[model samples]
Target: MSDIDPGQARPPRRVRVDLPGRAYDILIGAGLVDAAGSILAERLPDARLAIVTDETVAALHLDRLTASLDAAGIAHAVVTVPPGETSKSFRQLEHVVDAILAGRFERGDAVLAFGGGVVGDLAGFAAAIVRRGMRFVQMPTTLLAQVDSSVGGKTGINSPRGKNLVGAFHQPDLVLADTSVLDTLVPREFAAGYAEVVKYGLIDRPEFFDWLEWKRAPIFAGGPERAEAIAASCEAKAAVVIADEREAGERALLNLGHTFGHAIEAAVAFDPARLVHGEAVSIGMAQAHRFSARLGLCPGQDATRVEAHLKAAGLPTRLSEVPGAAIAREVLMAGIAQDKKVKRGRLTFILTRGIGRSFIAADVDAAQIDEFLAEELAG
Candidate 1:
């Protein structure tokens, strides 16, 4: 929990993910990209680097990062991919792995993920398999990556079967979250990321959720609240990763909205313009709460409060809000069936008793879900 004062200048924050033999630090601050050369030079003195980024981010921030590396005399090579969810495919993964091999980077060297979630997942997965396992670093540039994906070690590309089905649990050696870079994001992108920020609160931090409600405007305005939000999110995610790095237990709680969200994403074939990850999550979370209430597992008002807050933050919170053709019930249900959380042909979902009271419900009834989604679609 961060106690940053709104009126004071905030210092950089560090959240450590302390695994038994694989501990790493998440450094959150402004201008970290400009300082990356010295940072890498000090920590990984002898390791050459492979910088993997997307074109959009390459255009926006790659030169500054390269210059920083050059100044520190750290040897490096760059690999660029197209920007967007489509890049997280087997084809692109092969392309990146080949590029890394072309650089002749060794197992002891590092691969730096230099964009949003797509680049981080693609690059980290490449690092996991390259030379049997290279060191990985996350330099997340988007609000979503900075707060969630970059910290958790859940790296993977989407399968045609599902989102994030083909990947690995390769944690990064370090995560450099440059809040300054978020200034380059479009408003819609920022709002999408904010959905993940709102997630930490809904997943067991009612006090934090309360704080977000009070400070939403300041956070959106890029005040001290923004850094505090990022810091708090990293801290929240780090705590979960430390407890269950492989997502074998409590870690599943972090996917509070992902089961339904991934389904919606798969339904659209992961089109960003139709629906991005965070927006799908916003809708999924709202649906999760509404379903919880319908099942008498949570108070209806709690679900209402969650939806209202997310809507106020400029996020879409309903299936109807999703653009394009109506996502058929069968498509969404099939996506849910393919979710990684399913085990032994049984379903598992993170349901809530109220705000900050999420619990994993294994063996959830599929028929009930079908009925609930039907009502959701009709409304």
Candidate 2:
């Protein structure tokens, strides 16, 4: 049972991502969706909003948001796409851009991404390119989006060549992460998002990792720990984004498990049923630790501990755990090669020395990754 009451209103926690001239705040709490209209009305008083969401989120949350907007007398339009990873494509991007243009949204107007990472990415990209980049706001409805994607300015659509191959660094004007919305997620979806929460600890907060292990149940049960975890994760990400908004340097640390994870996602064709982003990241983080240990860079026990914690959280920590047909080593490697971190054919990965010690490893040998993939696939 949840320790927090569903109808209770908690004051929102704020994490600020302070970029040079485009700083934004991520407000996390219950009832944010219901309060969004007044919030937006206060911040962008004259600006009309184009709410871009997906079918799933729209069905579950559109009314609440629209009702709030209506209450505040804020003018808005909605553009909804099909749900899931498949919607983060060029076709959907075109559709969203066309809709915004058709609605005659001006540069001063805002594009509100009211879904998970896919919607945030797709809608943000549309906001970036349409009308030469309209103001963007993130109203992320999923755990994954709330803790990770919603804070960063990274926006894009997946290309046939690889995941997130086409995108832009368009910062959001504001981010509202309503923790209450997480209750509507299926267990698997919530677990997948929890994988990302674990990532912050893995990247550089060993104490946070230890805390997660102790508080896992409460988090899953929607206790105060759940909100605490989200706020901590956001703070971690905001620090990184503040230091390296463009991912030119330290921001890459945030992708600690993403290289291998993205490869697995690409191999599985980004199918949520097979493996969602957070689940792939769980596997990738485990693999990264294991690989680091294999290369004598990290302690083997740390890798085991990571896998153990992820498993306890109901996250898949191995590629073999991904459902459906076996993922080919070649396909996995192809996906890695197209990773955004790759530079001039040299593979760049976020590897760790141990818990809370992740770092960027540029110019990693491709052969080593191939060998690792072969071993993982064989298992």
TM-score of 2: 0.93
What candidate 2 gets wrong by more than 4 Å, as runs, is: 1-7, 374-379
lDDT of 2 by residue, 1-379 (tens): 1233555576788887788888788888878888898899998888899999998988898998999999899989999999877888989999999999999999999999999899999999999999779999999988989998977788999877666889998999999888888999999999999998999999999999999999999899887788899999999888888887766799889888898998888888777779888899999999999999988899999999999999998989887888899888889888889777788999999888999999888879999988987887787
For candidate 1, which ten residues in a row score worst on lDDT?
1-10
Q: Which residue pairs show backbone clashes in model 2?
A: none
Ten contiguous residues minimizing lDDT sum, candidate 2: 1-10
TM-score of every prediction relative to native? 0.93, 0.93
Displacement of residue 339 (Cα, Å) in model 1 is 2.5
- Report the Cα lDDT for residue 113, model 2: 96
